[model samples]
Every structure is written in structure tokens, then in C-alpha cells.
Target: MKTLDLLRLKRRQLTTLGAAVSLAAALLPGTLHAADAASAPEPADPHQWLEEVLGEKPLAWVKERNEASFKVLKARPEFEPLRQDLLGVLNARDRIPGVSRMGGFLYNLWQDEQHKRGLWRRTTLAEYRKAEPAWETVLDLDALGAAEGESWVFHGAQCLGPSYRRCMVNLSRGGSDAQVSREFDTVSKQFIKGGFELPEAKSQLTWLDENTLFVGTDFGPGSLTDSGYPRVIKQWKRGTPLSAAMTVFEGEAKDVAASVVVDRTPGHHRVFFQRALDFYSSSSFFLQGGKLVKLEIPDDVESGFWGPWMLLKPRNDWQVGGSTYKSGTLLITDLKAYQRGERKFKVLFQPTATRSLASYNLTRSHVLLSVIDQVASKLEEWDFSKPQAPRHREVKAPFPGALHLASLYDSELPRDELADRYVLYYTDFLTPDTLFLSRAGSDERQVLKSRQAQFDATGMRAEQRFATSKDGTRVPYFVIWPKGATADGSNPTLLYGYGGFEVSLQPGYSGGRGRAWLGRGGVYVLANIRGGGEFGPAWHQAAIKANKQRSYEDFIAVAEDLIAAKITSPRHLGIMGGSNGGLLMGATFTQRPELFNAVVCQVPLLDMRRFHKLLAGASWMAEYGNPDDAKDWDVIRQYSPYHNVSKDKTYPKVFFTTSTRDDRVHPGHARKMVARMTELGHEVYYYENTEGGHGGAADNEQRATLQALEYSYLWQQLGR
Candidate 1:
């Protein structure tokens, strides 16, 4: 469900499957022009008023629709029970508390029924190993919000490592991208008066030292880029006005953002500047002798520092030092040598046709590579201590689930102690998450925590199946069959996908989904189609812009494959996706309405033509394409869901969900689509959450309500 529209480009999520269905003749060039002609007010978007977001009329419309839809959805027999069960899962005190190492303690944020917001707490690693860790609260979000009279959602805190006494805590209202960063003293558990703080904005700040910060925020009108992100990165000194901050780096208004990332890695204190040219590419620079020294590398190639070692992962084929390195190859070189125009490198991981490096992390002495074989995950550890000839070893991990790796190394700790230890989290549809602590050089590991299963999984089983697309590309999908379910095409199956942005959909557990859907005998499917990283860069690049329709076609192929195999018929099949996948849901149903009976389109981008005009929409032009350009529009207009909804066709009773606080994708996309479809005599259900940003839920209660509403709607539409 990650929008991955570069909320500062920590892009780790992807999209689901979809279909390339039929396009009505009304969408033809002449007809499109006519419908968009001068006679119509705003032409094709007569329901443009809905895009006004918080306008009086739009809010009233949202309220009325929410009330109307909830009245019926609540009346369903399965709704309340589902809601209660999900709420239990959401508020369960026994749930594993994820922690991060900060100085002498592991910090965690815990929320329950009483603590609707959360508690920023800490405990010793020894205490964390216990069944019930004794937590000492550093800050109580519910208390802070109550005392401040702000509906603050904690966006996390960036504490200065080594000492970890000072922290920049980010808080967002409801759950928008705009974050207010306040400096806090961890020792006193209080915000520093008159310390460095930024008002609500999509801002980034890192502690260069206790007295200075590398800041990127909206300073004024010209400070923000066209995408509403910070165009300038400044170094702000303590006890100075934000306007007086010295500009360290600046990017053009057309660029996504300019940011300064300060790495206080003990002795290797370096300041890196990144100017994101687009959503997926950036030109990186480092401060050398008070001048910005640009990294002479491909803009799309990811470059980072691991101690004195330079890490590079080229997204495109890079030829250097008289040899060509293929895309998705993870290479390492000495930083000092690389800076001196020497391209001498050692290959840590090379991609085969079917295997691509998913992710990698560095310890004091090891390089842990998470690779993808077909769609499964594998871990490889390279002991980079001996730079010339590193030791590579295969790390055995649990499968049919995801194996997540994270370095336990705290930069503040002595390089020798914590750097070699890492955490691994494994989970799937049925398996509850198990957190393991392992040492890089040793195979032995200790289980730190394991989540209790919230659903009955006695007879449920998951299997991976491949579907041949129209272009003969084999798309993989995982299906979790419910107990006693037959393959006679009668199962109420819910197929989920998000096939965009190179974000691979790996195996993960969701108690809400498991209890409310699969536990109720619903078959769940996950599609690994084009526009995902399942097969790496080539797979993702194959579905961007003009060729984006391939993602839909690949998704359609999976649905067809399911029907052919008699797993589920069209009547009993439903589809669900969010963000870009929401657009997939829209395009799929419009193209082939008979293929699915239910759709849960959440926080989606529906109008492709005017999407650039929306909040953060301008940033995605590189991924989607510049609709302002007529050539790109020629192809985009075909798959644009809002434009393709046919008045003459019979579509499913689609359910649309969005949030008023979703500052990323505009709520107008959902509003206008619902308005257009409903006006065209189509049965549609719409719900606009007044809070909750792009995720469509603010707190656990709201999240539970959404699940209840969605599953209830699915059962009504697709279940017997």
C-alpha cells in the first residue's frame, strides 16, 4: 500500500497485477476531443468540483456518501464480527513490538486500546528478550497530543547517534506528508525550547552536529519545487531564523527535491547532497573543501558509503574501467580509489536472467545481499574484510514467507561490537512473524520475538503459479487456498496486486486480512506481474509510461489463468489494490467488467490527464509520463481509468475509499470517479475517511472499520 511517489524516495514498495481490457469507441480521438470540447464546462471533467478536496460541496458529498454507504455496509451480518476481530488484532497487547537500537537501549512505539496514539518507549536488549519487556516511556504521544491540542501522528524520530541525547521528532496531522519536526531531549523527555524546529511541510532534516542541521523544507514560495517538495537544502544553525539559513544545495523547480544527508559515521563524517532529477533518478554530490563535488556516476545508479567502501548498484548497464557492468549488479570499490577516478571494483552480487539483487546492507565486516530468484528471496553474506577476495556464504532462511534483513549496527556504537549483528524477520500468509537475531559471521541465531497467529490456519496452503501473458511473458502469482475449498470455480477468491514502481510484493502477514477474509473461506491471491521487481529492473522498466499497459495485461492474464484452472469464476472473483494499483482496479473493471464482481480502489490516481496538476502528482511524470505532452497522452489516454469508464457498459458495484488527509494522491481522483460513474447510472459505493492520509485509516479503530466495510462489501458482491 506504499504510494512510493518518492516521499523522499525511500521507495521499497511496488504494485499488483491488472488487465488490458476493451476500450469503448467513445474514447476514440474524435469522440474524446468532442467530449472535451468547449461546449462542456471544463469539458471531460464535468465533475471537477469533486476535485476541490475540502470544498463545501465536496465535503458534503463525501459525508453523504459515507453515511449512505456505511448504513448499508453496517447492516451486513458479517460486518460487526469482522470489525471486532480486526480491532482485537489491531489492539492486541501481545503483538510483537518492533525495536531500534539507540545508544544503550532499544526503542519501540507501542499502541493499544487505551493508547490510541502510541508510547515512545525504550528498554535494554536483555529486557527486550523477555516475554514482556519492561518498557520505560520516553514520550507518550497520546499525552503529548492531548496537552498540545493537536491530532499528531508520530512520523518517527531521528535521534543523533553516538550520544542519542538529542532527537528531531516528526509528527504529522491525521497522516499527511507534511511533517512538523521538533527537537527533543531524550534525557529529559521534553522538547527543547527554541531549538531547531520546522512547521508542517514535506521536510527532511538530519543532525550534522548538535548545534546545526541539514534542513530541506518550505522556506518560502520559491523554496518548494513544482511537486511541492523542498527545492533547496540549507544548513540551519541553532539560534538563527530559518530564512537566514545558509543554502548548501539547490535544485530546479522541475526537480523532485534537493536534500543534504549528513553521515556522522564516527571518524568518516561525510555530508552528501542529492538532487532528485525525477522520481527514480538523482544526481548526488558530496561536500569537499566547502565546494559541492558531484559524484561522476550515472544519475540512476544508486551510490552509498559503507565505512570507507563505496557501494554502487547501477539501474542501467554501466560501462566503466574498460568493462561493462550489467544493471542490478552490486559492486564495491574503495571510496578513496573511486574518488580518484579509479573504477577498480569487486562484484558482490551479479544478476542472472532470473535472479536479481533485491536489497543489500553493510555491517562492519560483512555485506548481506538479499537476492530474488524468480520471486523467492535468498540471503548471501560476503565478508568484505578481505577486500581483494571476500568470503561469500549462503545463509539458510525460512521460505514460503519473506526473510527480511536489517543491520543491528548502531553507528554510535563501537565499530567492533554491534555492526556484525543483524535482525531477520520472516512471515507469510499463514506463518506468524518471527524475529531472529543473527551474527554476520556465524550461522547460529536466537529468536528475539515471534508473533502469535491471530487466525486458524490448520488447512490453508499457499502455492505459486505462473500465467502466460498475451505477450508470452510468464507472470507469477501466489494463491493461498482456504480449508475445504474446491477448484470447481465456486470459491470466493480475492486477488490482490500492485504492479508498479519496482516494488515487489513479498510474503507478509496481515492479521486483519487473515481473520476477516481467508479465515472466512476466501481464497487470497498475490500477483507478481510486470512493473514489479520480481524479475528486477527489466521487469519494472517493461511497464513504465507508454508500456504501462503491460502491467494491466499481465494482471488480466493471471485472472484468466485462475478462471481457466477453475479456481474461481468471474462471479466469485474480486480484486483489490491501492494507489497505482487502484488505477489498475479502475482500468481492469472498465476494460472487462465481467471479469470481477467486486473492487476496492483505495487512495488511487484515476484521472491521468490532469494528474500532474494534483498534489505530488507532478513528481510522478517520469514514471507515468508527461500528460502535458501530446505524444505521451496518446498512449496514457487509453489506460487512464477516469477517461475510460464507459456509460454503456455494465461494471461491478465498485467501492471507492480515500482520505481527506492524503496529501500525496488527491482525494479528488476518487471523488470525481465516483461522481462520474454514479451519474452514469452505475451502482457505486464510496467512503471518504475524514482522517487517515494515503493509508485510508488514522488509528486502529478506523483501520478496523475500513477492513470491516471492505470485506462486508466483498462478501455481498462476490460471496454466495
Candidate 2:
């Protein structure tokens, strides 16, 4: 599932196997708590108690573990310095105030030392273009939270289309997925009396009109999926109570989720019901004349509307009206005509072996697409209003760093009056983020803002290189290292990766990494492995389910290449990843224990066999096959890190981190993994923050402390 706001948080090279030392003497006996080994096929998880998220016993366990880990890392001299440096970067007032165009005004949320909770404000477009825009405060979260005695964190808002005078403001307590939404009048700068409001739950709502709302929230029993997301959607009228709202759609309890999207584009004001059957599969239906008419398309194909046309992006090859559209092809068709049984389509973009559609945004009369060619970004604009077939033109923003484009289209404006404008964001390993405003079809671009450099990147250099995986696939990766660095394999290097969920890891500036690691003369590597969307859906599908091993193999290839190139050795090399990448780190730690000296696994899913049984893990069954199935288990068991951790293996000094407030991926995965390793005679460090959701940290200070501890651990373990 996509987060609602920002801050959301390879060639085979064989390495010698490290000799296994006697761990039985070093480990504490009977540390496994209590579980009958003969009760089940594999022993029942002895540390299952940790799964009870707010339980007193589990919290005590978390506190003890956190204190122990904190004491060791805090004792390091670099800890305090790292914390201060990161906190400074995070709280810098010079950072760019990113804006969103709404109601003919640019809205922005500012947070710093003065306003830690942030201030949501807006300014006129002309004023925003100036060096010092005069911002009018719409809401001060710090003040509101203090007045209400709540830890209210802004989750964002859904403003009514056209006028945008009314909005539903989403606020989360301590940065959790669950949020409390309240309707407010932007023009009046106050909560709307008797307006639509929803209590704390993993909920979402969108504006259907000034007084109508299409919402998906917890509506009592049997209204939520096993993933803890809403399974039912209701259409609530202005004067009616939410409890009496009309039920528009309902999904099964086993379904991943059910959400509604209301398109407000001129001539395409339609409401659509989206039922997510699994992580990557969904069925879409648009409301027409009081009926939910299901879209006649493959379940795996992603369907959406752009202006007056329906955009279809298929994950698998689809044959419609005897025409076979290749996978990864972006097909567009007239929305009204298609609904009336027309099977014709216009190809906006097609996939190649090296080129794929990264993403697409819409201008008033044009379609702007950001394409990835060999893991680099390129832009193109299509004018579909032409009498003949749509003509495509290149909209170039040439740069070494990754460039992402977002179109500035307001449905309230007419096509002729709309400006051909889009927002451009660019960044790399060393370069700070630069925001630009440019015309979509033309090259008339102006620098809107540039982030101040958070670290001294004078000697750092970024280079894109390829590593051949075991299957002979050329996987690309980016490495940032100091100039004049030697190839003697003495420099400390940290390789990071995430190979699942179609999420691409692009080259972006990281102040924490720059100050803590790069400034200390270290190499940083980002692997664009299979299962990531660096090359689009095809790249991701290549390493999913039964073929998930491809991702693990691809990661190992990059690690071996780093060592082979003599950039860093096993003694100095380290690895880190969170969420899905945490699974990657776990597999690497257990499967190739001799490859590195340090591993940082954060908020990860280590117990693959039981992953689906956890909180939101059931939603990802499509990404990783159901482990309960015997055939799938046979393949999954081969790489299940929790099951693979052996008492006899020589493992690296690993650091595991998690959060008690992570209602998405259960923190039990990390807790249980660490417990098993320790019980098996390996000492590991762990820290479970009490607050923060899946992103792992609530505010800037919490983020700073977490980064300091991690970098300190890496320096202590990898740096010589």
C-alpha cells in the first residue's frame, strides 16, 4: 500500500566459507523461553510472546533489549557527534519548503526547531515564485496538538476538487498508519462544524462533492481485512450520520483491502471502487448510474483514468479484441467509448529490454511520462488532442542524477487555459535535491528551489556500474566513494538494497549517510537488483514468488563484485536494509555468513514461513507465495532466514531494529529472529522504539538518535 505522505518512511563471486567455532560454550542455556520442539514440524516460535504488540510483558522485553543495545552504542565516542550532526541536518530551516498547487495557491508544510510539529500554510503562485514568499498560516500543528493535548502528526488532506475550500484533514498519533480525520474549511481556517470525521483507524476518504464523501473506514465488526485495512466502503451524504451511510462496496476478510477513488477531471468525474485481492492484484469498478460496473480487464492489469481516456498498464500479456498487448505496455482508450463496448486502444508507451515506463502524470491536454532507460531517467510528453494519432515529443531535463517529473494539472481549469507546467525533482548520492518548474511540452524551465547541502561533498563521486548476476543478467548499481580512494580493499563500504514490492532505489542525497559514513572516508553502494522497478514491472516480476531466489542471488552478486573490485573486503564491508530489504539482509546473513562483518536488519520479515500469519503480512501473499502450500513451502524453506539460522554457523555481528508501533509489518519478526540467534549462541544487538510506525521514527529527534546508533555500530564493527 502507498503511504499518504512524505517521510514515509549480480555476477557470482565465490567467497571462502568461514570456519564455524564452538558457540555452545558461549551461549546461555535455556534462553529459548518455552516451546515444545516435538509439538509441530518446526518448533513453535518460543518468542511468540513478543508478537503481542502492546503487551506489558513484550514491552518489558523490548525495553531491556533496547537499553542493552543503547548502552553499548552510546559508549562510543562517535555516537554523540553523529547524533548532533544528524539532528542538525534534520532540523535545518534552510531546507527547501516543497509546495503543492491547490486552489490557485501553493501549499507547504514547514517543520524545524521553531515548529517541530510543522505549520501548514499557503501562498499565491506569484508570491511563491519569489525568494521569500509571504506564507499565510492555515494550521499550526504544534499549537493544535498542544491545545488538544495530543501527539497529532499531519497525515495530509483530501481537498474538494475545483474550489478546494473544504477538506478532510488526516492526523495520526505518533506517526502511525491509523489516523483520525476531521473535515475543515480551508477558507475559514477552522474545523467544519458537524462535518465528516473518522476516528483512529487505517482509514482513507476522498471528496465526491462539497457534501458527499466516498470513505473506507472501520465500520464495526467484519469490516476490516486481515491486514487491518478497511474491507468496506461507504458513500456518506452531508446531512446523514456516517453509521447510516450507504454501503457502496464490500470485500472479503481475506482480501488485502478495499478503497475508493473519485476522479474529478472535467468530463470524467467518476467514482471507482478498487478491491485489492492481493498485493499486486485488484479488481476495479466504476460507478455508473447507481451501479458498480466492473472494468472488463485482467485482474493483474492496473487501470486508471487520465483526462477523458482510460490508461491500462498490464502486468501480464493481455489479448483484447484479438489484439495482444505486451506486458508493461501503456494503453489508452477513450473512457466513454470503452465503457460502451469499444475495444480499440492507443499505445502511449511500449516496453523494451532496456527501457520501461517509470511513471506518468497528466497535464491539462498532455501526458507527461518519466521513462527509465538502463536505470537512468528520461522524460517524454504526448499530446493526445491532435486530430491524428497522438504525437510524442521529448522533454529533456539532462542531468547525472535521477530526475522525476510531476505534472501540475488542475481539473478546475479549462484545457485551453491550463498551463503546460510540471514540477521536476533531481538528486544524486552527493548532490542535494533541486526542485524546478518547467513546461511539459517545452523546455522553458526555471529553478524553483534547491536544498542547501547538508554535508561537505567536495571529494565524493558517484558512478553507475553493472554487476553480472549468476544468471548472466547485468544488474546496475551506484557507488559513491571519496576521490583518490585506493583499490586496496581497505575502505569501509556499506551496500544497501531492497529487492521486492516494485520499489526502485534511485540515487538520492542522504545527509545522514553523507555525514556519518561518507565523510569518514567510506564507500556507499545502492544495488538496483531484480524485484525492483528500476526497469519497471518486468524487472520486479522477474524475482517474485517461486523465483524470489533470483533477488537473493542478485544481491550476493553485487557484494562479491564490490570485494572483487577491491573497493572493500569482507572485513570492512557492511550491509543494511529495512522492511522487504530486511528480509534480504536476513537471507544474506544466514546464507553467506562469511561475506561481511556487520549487518543491520530493521523492521524486517525474517520468518517467511509465518510471515503471512502476522499483521499485514497476509497482504503480500502475491509477492511471496503462500508458505502454507506444500509446494511453495519447499521453495520458501530454502531461504527462510528464521528456519535457516543454525547453531553451528559462524554469523556476523548483526544489529536488528524494530518498532512497537509498526502496525503493518509485525515487529515480532525482528524480535523472534534476534531471540533465536541469541539462543543459538550468537550475541546480537536490538532496539525497538516505542513510537513510530513502519518508517521506524516519529519525529526528527527520534530519527537522529536511530541513525546515530546505526552509524556508530557500523563504525565500531566495520571501520578500522
Candidate 3:
């Protein structure tokens, strides 16, 4: 599940901690207020002590809870087999070796039983296309970790443009967001001696060239945001003391963060300074002749440049050049003209009540658009051969599943050049992922690879169904079940959701979920509720702050829809979510305890009252209203799982999962909530992995084990 957070990891990685940096020269009105100081005096939260993440008492409490939960979950009859089966799927060598385009090579990070920490290897484009390519290992993470005596997780590397040999390799100690970045020479396959390096912190570094970097980190006092992210961007040169680096930009302490991003598209090597004012909004600036020039655009808009076009995807309505563009509109203008005060925009895509743009990528002469109509995938390729206007053509997908497109490996051409080749990945609840290579000017698409099905899906079928929500709005959901399964209200069904941050919940291949749940005749449901990009910004904005309960209500509507259709009863129904979705689960089970039999809330933010005071929580105030605001708290406290828990209410046995090393959402949210619930005499199980970050697993083994534990708990509770 996608969380509203960003981290220092490669963009290709499936997970992120939160949004990128936000900076400001001065504090906005009320931005510097203490998050912990409520508008009114508040009663002490008895379990508050658990918020001390690494404190002795909390560790002891965590250990005790882990042992207790282990006795219950591990004792399940299916736990061992489920774990072993998942392990086999995870360790399978036949899985797709996802490639990254860097320099002149196609790079991949592979992990298996033999190399749990993974191996950073690369190959030529031709060799990568051929089966069983000859790969050159550049970094062996397992060996490096062993040699350094640290559980080093490879965050990723930012290589210099063009030649792309020198890079800043980010390494996390035990899967935390704080990581140490070291300069490495890809050609030599070794760390560069006397090269640039940044010690561990939630940091960001972009290469201005090989010898200089735009750095943002915890640089001494007052250099970090309240969210524990870098608040200053500095220009650091090689062979100089970090303290001597010139501060180029500074952000407000209350702002999320500020960092520099260099568009490494060769000739289009533009440097940008971004200030994430909050989780979903930011102001961006482009460096021109050593001066920071603010881009004339809304802070809520997402802007980028491809070729000669300046692109804008606005989350709010914008009025420019006598045209009022609606929210969720994608507009384009000539970059030179835009800089010269030409506000006229070419409308590329617009969202309807039922359709919204999920993602878009620029090719050499076209823009590949991935739009979701009612949560179903729709592909469109717009040819911008003529800069004045572009001709659009819809590319029909070969199969019925969620389709995602990416450029071919090593296609890092500049904006002026074409990135005509792309790889399309399509999959759903039952279908294994299949990859296809498509060229901009070609009609024929080549099948590049297909993942082997981890579980037999011979009789399984996926159906899209809608349910009426509390506000009488229709909510869509996908249910994957056996073809012959009847709506007898007896099937053990698992419902998942992540209804925040405009993140669309699209269908994808999940071998672990398929094998652990569906292979056992269990049903899986993905709810496309409000507060998501399923229908775009309007859909998400409909459930923010005071309206946040709408998302929970929408989720309940889907749950009730399943029960009303006789698909599953509350006694047989379960729910799972992480990060913001974790908040969804907590709110749901608390507000409507009778609706679900089990819940797997992982790396969640439960204690809304103090969430802002926690690591990275304050940054998300845009998505979730600040608790310090009494007006906002009035609504927040109404559904906050921690504040809403009651001793008199009977709650289902919930399994709380988190990572001690998670530097994003503090593990304290889970620990304190569980502690409070247990104190209130509720049935709850807890497990805190010592390593995994916000995603809750550092590697596949931990991932499989965690999945096993979750599935085991669900089955044991639902009587599957």
C-alpha cells in the first residue's frame, strides 16, 4: 500500500516513505507553532510513555507482546505451511528481474535465498533483452554488509548525468530512512577514495556534476524540519568540509522539507529547488544563472518539463490566459514561452467525475498517459511531433488488467531526444504480471517477459462491483474469488484499502497474497473508496480533514456491500492496510467494530492526537488536519482509534505490526495504541520487526514471514 511519505530510495522501488522536500525562506503564518501544544488543555494519555521509540520500557513491552502474539499466531495449523510456500515464491529465481535505466547499462537489484541482501548488477541493453543475460555485479550488498558488520540496505544511487559512472550510493543501516551516502565509481566497482559522502540522516544529494552536489541533510542545529527531514539545501563541493558548503536555500522548520532535484536528462540538466509545504502541496523553483527563480504556478500543482513543453498537472482549478482549467487537468505550454509570460496552455488531459489521470510519462515525441476510468486502466499515446499541437491515439491494451508503462532500460536521453521504447506491465488479482516492449512509431509490441503464477488460478475470476456509501455515493471495488464460489456469507474474505493522498489502488500481481489467501479458497477484495486518485483530486479532497470520515464510511459501505451480497459475513470478513490505510483500518474497526472480524494494521498512524508530534507526521497536515487545531481535532478525535477506544466496546482480535527502525511514521503509534487497547482489556496481538522500515520488511524473507503471520492471523480468527 502507498503511504503519503517519501524516503531516500530509488524511484523504481515500489515503496516510499513520504513526499519530497518543501522549503521556504520564512515561516508561513502559524507554521512554527508547537504541534504538541493543543489549543486547549488535554488529559494525559496514559500510554504516552510507549512513544519513546527505543526506550528501555517500550522495548520490554514490545518483547512481551511479541512473545504473546507468537504463541497465538505460530500455534495456528496453517502457519508453517503458509510461510514455507511464501518463502518458495519469494525465493524463486524465475521472477522478473526488473531493470533500471542508468548510464549505458540496464541495472537490477536481485535478492534470493542465496543473496538475501541482494546484488546490484548491470548488463548491456542487448544482453538484458536476451534470456539469462551476462550480468556484471557492481555491488554485493550481503558481502558489503558482512564486511562492514552492519545490516546495510541499499537505498539506491544517484549517478552523474551523461557518462553516469560516478554515483552517490545510499545505504541504510537496518532499513531505516536515515542512511549514509557514499560516492562510488561504477566502472571501478568500488567506493571512490576521498570522494563525497554524507553521514546518516533523512538526506538528499543531487549531482550538479561529478565534483559538486546540492546537499540537504541534518546539518547541525536548526537544519531539520519538525518532521525530521532536511530543511536546507546547500551546494557542497568535492574536497571541502561539509560545514563550508554554501547554503543555497532554507525552509521553514514547520515545513515538510526542502531539497534540490537535478533533471538528469543530458542537455536538459535543469536544477530545481522544491519545498514540500505539506504532504500534497509544494512550491518549486528553477535555478537560472545561479539565481533561484520561482516558477509561476500554483503550489498544489505538479509541474515538470519534457522536451520544449512545460507541463502542469494541477490539483486545483487554475485560471490563466483567459482559460479556467479545472482541477485534475493536465496542461502543457512551450517552456520558453511560459518563462516569457505566455500563459496559454494546451489541454492534454482532463478528469471527469468518473475518470482521472493516474500517471504520465514523456517519450521522445509522445506522452504516454495512464488514465483510470472508474479504476480501470486506459492507455493513450499522444504524439507531440508538432510542438504547437499534438495528435492523440488510444493504445488498446491486449488484456483486461491494470496496465503501467515505463521507458526501456538505459533510455536516459535528454528532453530534446526521444525515449520511444517502453515496457508495459499488466496484471490483476489472479493474472501473473506480463511485460511488453512497445515503440512509439511501431504497431507491433514485443512480449519481453511474464511472471510465473505463484498459485493456480484456474477457476478464479475478478469482478468489478459497486456499493453505496454512507453519503449515498457509489464506491467501486474489485473482488477476486473462485468461479464456482457462491455468495453464501461463509467465505473468508480479506478487504484492502489505501484511501488517501490521491493514490489510486490499482490491481497488480501479488504472488504472496494470491498464494497465501486465494490458493486456500479465500477471497480478496480491493476497495476503491474516496480520498484516492481512482477518480482524481476531487475524489481525494472529498475525504480530507473534517471529511476524512467519508473514506472510512466509504470503506464500510464496500464491506457492507460484500455482506449485503451475501459474499461474506462480519464473522468471516477481514481488513488490512498500512500507513494511511492503516489509519483507515484503525478508524473502521473502532467506529464500526461489528463490521470486521480481524484487522492487520501495519506501520500505522493510530494516535491522531499526537501524530503531528511524531516523526514525519507533521508533514501530512494537508492530508490529515492538524490535531492542534481545536476545530480539526473536533472531527479527528471523533474517529481517532486511540481516542475512540472504549473499555465497554468489544473489539475483534487485531494484529498490530510495525518496524522499530521505521523513521517515517513512528512505531509508537502502533505500540501505544496496542498498549492502550490491551490495558482496556481488548484482544490485540502485536509484532514489531526490529529492522524493516515503514514498508515493514527489508527483504523478501521478512516480507514473506510478515505475510505468513498476517494470513495466519486472519485464518485463525475467521475460522477458515
**Which candidate wins on TM-score?**
1
Model 1, 1-720: lDDT tens digits are: 001234533333222221111223235333544234324333244677777777998899999999999999999999999999999999987788888888788888888888888899999878988988899999999999999998888888888878899999999899887899999999999999999889999997788888999888989889988888888888889999998899888999998877777777777888888888887788888898999898998888888787788888888899999999988899989898888999898888889988989888778889999988868788889997776778999988876567788787876566446778888888887899898989997878899999888898999998999999989999999999989898999999999988887878877788888898899999999999888888888888999998999999999999999999999999999999998888888888888788999999988888887888788888878778987665676678887887788788899999999999988888988988888788788989999998888777768888889989999999998887
Off by over 4 Å in 2: 1-42, 415-418
* TM-scores for every predicted model: 0.96, 0.93, 0.94
| TM-score, prediction 2 | 0.93
Number of clashes in every candidate structure? 12, 4, 16
lDDT (10s digit) by residue, model 3, range 350-412: 889887998887777788888898787988878877756679888878556688888652324
Distance from true position, residue 326, model 2, in Å?
Answer: 2.0
Window of ten residues with lowest summed lDDT in model 1:
14-23
How large is the C-alpha RMSD of every model relative to the true structure?
Answer: 3.2, 5.4, 5.0
Residue ranges of candidate 1 with Cα displaced over 4 Å = 1-44
